[model samples]
Target: MLEAARTTPTALWNDSSDLSELKQSIAFGGVGATCNPVIAYSTIKKHLDVWRPRIEAIAAANPTWGESQIGWQAVRDMSVEAAALLKPIFDEHNGRNGRLSVQTDPRFHRDAKALADQAVEFHGLADNIVVKIPATKVGIEAIEDATYRGVSINVTVSFSVPQAVQAGEAIERGLVRREAEGHDVSRMGPVVTLMVGRIDDWLKHVVARDKLFVDPSALEWAGVAAIKRAYEVFQARGLRSRVLSAAFRNVLQWSELIGGDLVVSPPFKWQEIINASGYDVVEKINEPVHEHYLEELNRIPDFRKLYEVDGMTIEEFEDFGPTRKTLRQFLEADADLDALVRDILIPAP
Candidate 1:
């Protein structure tokens, strides 16, 4: 476990940030941490006793702002605090690790400049901040612009080989543009996340809804297969951006991608469970997904769209089944955050 945490260039990450957690998980071998708007909302709700007063102060100080503005201010403050705790480690890693990823508003998904502009602002909040832009078409454009402006990016809302590859290519283009202008790209560490579990979840939903006869176990490997193929594509093309595995469901979410230069981030709850399990971490990244499981899983058209390199086009990404599902869920999280702030700003009678 120590070897898995320290030796491998694969950055072990905890998807949540807290004071003790920042120390504990990093000491347990995490070099990076990530937060989406959903996690940010959850963090505020988790510590209402501590943040409620400050939130009230924010509302008072920003009388011109709505719930969305007040809520996002909370996220900004939380992210900066987490980044402070990780700064030393970030310095130690020379920018490869010790990053706190703050996501842009999901509501801005259709607007490239809104996403990129927010990303640049968040990137200014902390030196170690890696901003997450969704993998939608506009997001890809936003990501490239943000990167050219020197924002280290973490691509989110991605679930397939095509999305990962496209995002990676976008980052590469941005890097090259920066280099052309004599900018330093050395300290920038950008990663494209392949949310393995979410893809698996969507496939499972499809299997049950359609009453398809896929082998039960085949569903488990759907995400693993997509990531494995994506990793291969990344390697074969020499893309500078790394592939990150997120949304852990089973141990394979963390276990199977052990050795590759991958970022395996489980949420804080599962991080404790995984750290306690004492599972032997070995090099399994290069190992191919079982051919039988692949064959069974490919029975689903969605799986093929995810598993194949040409599965979806840039134009088609926003409408893809899993993409739509995740975007809806993330947007709902923003709405929930707004409602949370609204209740405090204007107490319900």
Candidate 2:
């Protein structure tokens, strides 16, 4: 089994660019990569010379396939190449952390039925692929239904506790359904990506209340605390999904959660952080396990009730200004962001 500190290192890469550098980074330590249409469009636009032949070839046989078709095909091909690059680690770790995630276009974010259909199609293109879904109302519903059908999901763009909890229950409900049917539940690993930096970037107004100012230390600490509390709830409920810390804007956030199961970071930043340290530290945190949390979850009348609840979401919290403001509120809360910052970031020298 892979150690917790080694967890998984997934990064975002431009789909059409020379994956040579990206591949080299993966060889160094990156476990997987995440790509979207915007990334695909931008990457291909910038490096069409590198990607034209590949895209044209895919579009050749299926003459009917248009821009959308070609875009999604690129998504699959990039993910497959990334998975192949990490195959050694996958085989070595027995499939624990060497996994790549690819997101469906944001255009499908609210269309549950179409999103589920795309999930199935994407899974067929790559066996190691974990289909990424937005945490919208319909998207969460699609995640629950698709997981029940045996599709692994990565719930993306999550920003609040409520959103994270909903994602956990959706995966658990699927696992429970599968277990009851005597199906193999071993390959299932759902992930909820808590975008911390964006929150701090959004909630800047409250950074300084009447007489206090929020520091990067406080922002980093509060984000981890929120994610930790969510994981605690997941353990309590015996949920099978894992937490993936993502949208990390700095090295500090990644350092704080080095013990987390997986963190999909930006490609360039991850490389910088790993090299600056020049060495891996001894693991310090244990995987959280709580039997009572599981028992309480089992007693629930319907885990799906969370679907109806509305709270902060990536939708309502779009852009940096709002995230910065919300983050400041957490720092100002009674939640002890100071203590968390000290423990997670300021390691003993």
Off by over 4 Å in 1: none
Model 2, span 1-349: residue lDDT tens: 1232344332222121236655755544665555544444555555656666776676676777555555556556766776676567556655454566767656565588888888877766655667777666677888887788878788876665567788778878877887789988686657776665554443333444323333334443444455665766766777778776666666555555555454545545455556566555433224332344333322221211221234345344333243334334422321232222233324568
Query: Each model's TM-score?
Result: 0.98, 0.72
lDDT of each: 0.89, 0.56
Candidate with best TM-score: 1
Query: Model 1: which residue pairs collide?
Result: none
Report the C-alpha lDDT of model 1 over 112-213, residue by residue, as the tens digit: 999999999999999999999999899999999999999999999999999999999999999999999999999998999999999999999999999999
Clashes of each: 0, 17
Model 2 alpha-carbon miss at residue 197, Å: 1.8
